[model samples]
Target: MFIKECAGYELEKEKSNTSEDFFNRSVVTFIDGSEEKTLHVLYVRYFDEFIQEFTPYQQDPILTKDNIQVTFKDIVALVCLIKNPGLRNRKRLYINSKPEFTSYFQDIDFDKLTDVVLSVKQNNKFELRSPLDYIIQTR
Candidate 1:
């Protein structure tokens, strides 16, 4: 089910021009039969490349129920999930990195991260009434 949903998201991403439509995409999973958690894996692309480039170590792949190996991509995806966009917009937002992967992100330059996030936010803007308004007005 999760794999299928990921495939669907990939298809949508390929067909769309901007990621704004998927900015709020997330997955909810049950924990301990009584608890639930929401994961924003769809935002993994925001940190994928940067993490991959900076980290030389990799975690041992774990096989899922579907027999899929969860590799570095999955690790990065889990780490990058933005639980609260509202809180993230603030001047300082603390994110806890998993102990195993702490070294991978400990050296991140916040200024660069902020610039990247701001750039993504700026580029993703589109008029809600008409998605093509910017394109039309530019001509």
Candidate 2:
């Protein structure tokens, strides 16, 4: 399936005093068709039950007509496998891995996601499908 469009991001921070130290983000690329399928740049920061615990803390405040688009955390596990150039060129994750790298999604811009999609596809652990892939509902 072709990933027609994509987006995913996080605008959060810990209890910090000043905003300078706070974390910010930049957009990534949207889609591609180089070799293997390419998933967006969505990833997880933790493993184990920590994921379950870390979730409820996400922003859910319903204010000023905003959205709470969440990006699942497994995509990080998939990234860890793409560090090496050889593996990346091969388009597959062939090393010890975790189960969390199974499913995830988000609503980020193309800039912040393109590199990730390229890297992930380079390692071959993701499935880049078009939004229609789900909307169409094929068996």
Give a tens-digit lDDT track for model 2, residues 26-139: 122222446433333323322322434423223322011123232333223222222221222332232212343322222222233433444443443334343332222335
Q: What overall lDDT, based on C-alpha atoms, would model 1 receive against the true structure? A: 0.31
Residue 62 Cα positional deviation in candidate 1, in Å, after optimal superposition:
9.9
lDDT of 2 at 34: 62
Worst 10 residues of 2 by lDDT: 57-66
In the range 1-139, model 1's lDDT, one tens digit per residue, is 0111111132145455665543323332212223333343334233333444455443333223344443333333222322222321233222233343344344444333333233323342111222122121322
lDDT for residue 33 in candidate 1, whole number 0-100: 25
Residue 66 lDDT (model 2)? 25
Please give the CA lDDT of all the candidate structures.
0.31, 0.31
List the candidate 1 regions with Cα displacement exceeding 4 Å: 1-11, 14-17, 20-33, 44-46, 57-68, 80-104, 107-139
